[model samples]
Target: MRDLTKGGKDRTIFIGKSLMTFLKGHFERYQEIKKQLGHEFNPNDLIFFNSRGDYLKLRELHRAYKNAIKRAGLKNARFHDLRHSHASILLKKNVHPKVVSEQLGHAKSSITLEIYSHVAPSLQEDAAHAFDEE
Candidate 1:
C-alpha cells in the first residue's frame, strides 16, 4: 500500500474480505462515474478522487470524517482514532504485536507496543489463567 503518512515509506497491509468487497464496489462506482463523464476520465486517476478526478485534500477528508463522527453521535473522535481502534481490537483478539505494527506501518514492533501497551494488562491476565488451566 502507498504510504500517505509522514514516514513516506511504502508498506504492505492486508485487508479483510469485507474491505475487499467494499473496495470492489467503490471501484465499480468509480468506473460508472467515469463512463458517465464520456471520454473525460483518466485511466490513471486515483482510486479516491473528486468528480473531476482530483485527489481529495486532507482538510476535505478530515471534515467529512468529522461530520460522520458527529452524525454517529461519537464525541471527541478524530480520524486518527480509527487507527488506534483497529490496533486495540486486534490486540484484544490476541494478534501479535509485530503483525499489528506491520499493519500500522510502524517502524518497529516496539513502537506498536509502546503506543498500545495499555491493552496488554487484560491479555496478560488471560494468559495467566490459560497457563493455570494447562
Candidate 2:
C-alpha cells in the first residue's frame, strides 16, 4: 500500500503473481537457513531477512537496488528510474493517462501527462496510422 497524498488521496498496488512466487521462494530458502541455525520458522516473516532472521533495513534495500542495476549493466540508471521506465512503456502502449496515473498512484493525471504522455518516435508512428483512412 502507498499513501498518494498528504491526506486526500489513497491508493494500493497489488503485486503480480510472478513477484509473489519469487518472494515465496526466497522466504522458503531463508527459512531453511534459519532452521540450520536452530531457529524456529515463522511463516509471517518479512520479505527480506537478516542472518539472525531479523527484518532487513532500508540500507540493505538501497544496496540491493544498486547492485541489481549494476549487474544488469544499466550503468547510467538509478533505482528510482524504474518507475519512470514502467510509465514510459505504458504510455508508449497507448494506455490512457488516467489508467497509468492510477497504476502510478499519482494524485493528478496531469502529472502523468507532464512526465510520460509525450509521444516517442515509435509511438508517434503508431498514432499516425491509428487514424489513417482504410
Give the top-scoring candidate (TM-score): 1
Off by over 4 Å in 2: 1-10, 38-44, 118-122
**Candidate 2 RMSD computed on C-alpha atoms after optimal superposition onto the true structure:** 3.4
- Candidate number with greatest lDDT: 1
The list of candidate 1 runs beyond 4 A from truth reads 1-9
* lDDT values, one for every candidate: 0.86, 0.75
How many pairs collide in each candidate, listed in order?
0, 0
Model 2 TM-score relative to the real fold: 0.72
Q: Against the true structure, what is each candidate's TM-score?
A: 0.85, 0.72
RMSD of each: 2.5, 3.4
